[model samples]
Target chain A: MARVIVDVMLKPEILDPQGQAIARALPRLGFSGVSGVRQGKRFELELDGPADEAALSDVRKMAETLLANTVIEDFSIRVEE
Target chain B: MARVIVDVMLKPEILDPQGQAIARALPRLGFSGVSGVRQGKRFELELDGPADEAALSDVRKMAETLLANTVIEDFSIRVEE
Candidate 1:
């Protein structure tokens, strides 16, 4: 089975409260030196066939339609061996 | 500024309902051939300096203590150019 990875992250212009919270919490937890943090989603898909052009195309459509909200988030896809 | 990527994923044995929901919806949406799906989290961290061993070590602690629930999830870290 071929595996596909899709990473969906909020646009740089959008404010990410989740990321801010982590940045704020870091110092208190005794971990420092991190300047910024952004949290996002990752999807791993198992396909029945090879992750060729056709499969990747289908995955892109899936990412655009179901995996990510394109207006506020952007997604990129990668195929795994 | 150096960037580090942390990808947190559910344990292989754990049940992923969110992934299952997406898998079920794929066929109805006219997308097929996907056998399974797993959903996870990705964190992008910006640091003040290079991603050296010390920095990666600190990030690992962050991932274990805050970013990932070690009981049910596993995380991997990568340094980005």
Candidate 2:
């Protein structure tokens, strides 16, 4: 089965509270030298069949329409065997 | 400057509520044949300096120490020039 990886991230201009919370917790956890932390989302999809260009296109549409909020987030897709 | 991409995902045994929400929304968005969506996190870090093996190790530690929750999540890191 084909596997696809998708990444979704908030727009740079947007304030990411989740990322900020993680960043604040880092030093307390004993990690220093880390400056910024932006939180996003990752998705792994296992296709029932072979992944083709058409299937990928459909997935892209899915991402735009439902998987990602285009108004505040961006997404990327990677397909693998 | 060097760039690094980090992906964090929930353990397979963990039920992902966010993923479930997204999966449920797909059919309404006109995407069929899509089954599962497990949500995770992605981080893009711009290194303050060159990225070497040592730096990568440090970043890995950072991920373990703060960026990811070992109890429920796993993470992968990639560095690029």
Candidate 3:
């Protein structure tokens, strides 16, 4: 089976409440050096079949349509054995 | 400024309801090639100082204590310009 890793990140202009909350929590937790934090999503997909060219294309299509919100987020895909 | 990326993933034995929900929704959305999906969190941290060795060590400490749960999750850190 071939494994695909998809990273979905919000656009630069978007405000991430989750990240902001984490940033705020860090200082209280004694980690005062961190200036900012942005949170995103990562998806690891194990495909049923081969990791061929066609499979890569199919995975990209899936990422574009379902895994990420194209208007507000950007996604990147990588293949791992 | 320095950027650090932290990858947080649940343990293999842990049940990921979010990933399961996404997998189930994929077929309904007409993207049926995905066999299994595991979801995780990605954190991008912006530090106030340079990306030096000291900064790297500090960030790793932050990840170990606050960014990941060692009992049920694992985290990896990376430095980027």
Judged by TM-score relative to the true structure, which candidate is superior, 1 or 2?
1
Q: For candidate 2, what is the TM-score?
A: 0.85
lDDT of 3 by residue, A25-77 (tens): 98787776678999999999988887788888888888888889999998888
State the lDDT of candidate 1 residue by residue for B1-81, as single tens digits: 799999999999999999999999999999999999999999999998899999999999999999999999999999988
* lDDT per residue (tens digit) for residues B30-51 in model 3: 7766799999999999988887
lDDT of each residue in B6-35, candidate 2, tens digit only: 888999999999888877888777776767
Candidate 2 Cα misplacement greater than 4 A, ranges:
A20-32
10 residues in a row with least lDDT, candidate 3 chain B: B25-34
Instruction: Considering the two chains of model 2, state its CAPRI-style docking category.
Output: medium
Question: How high is the CA lDDT of each candidate model?
Answer: 0.97, 0.80, 0.87
Q: What is the lDDT of candidate 2?
A: 0.80
Error of 1 at A30 (Å): 0.7
Q: Superposing all C-alpha atoms, what RMSD in Å does each candidate have to the true structure?
A: 0.5, 2.1, 1.8
- lDDT, residue B61, model 2: 90
lDDT of 2 at B69: 95
Candidate fnat values, all: 0.93, 0.55, 0.85
Question: What TM-score results for chain B when candidate 3 is compared with the true chain B?
Answer: 0.89
Across A1-81, the per-residue lDDT of candidate 2 in tens digits comes to 677888889999999998788777877877655577788888887666667888888889888877789999999888965
Query: What are the models' TM-scores?
Result: 0.99, 0.85, 0.88
Q: Which stretches of model 1 miss by more than 4 angstroms?
A: none
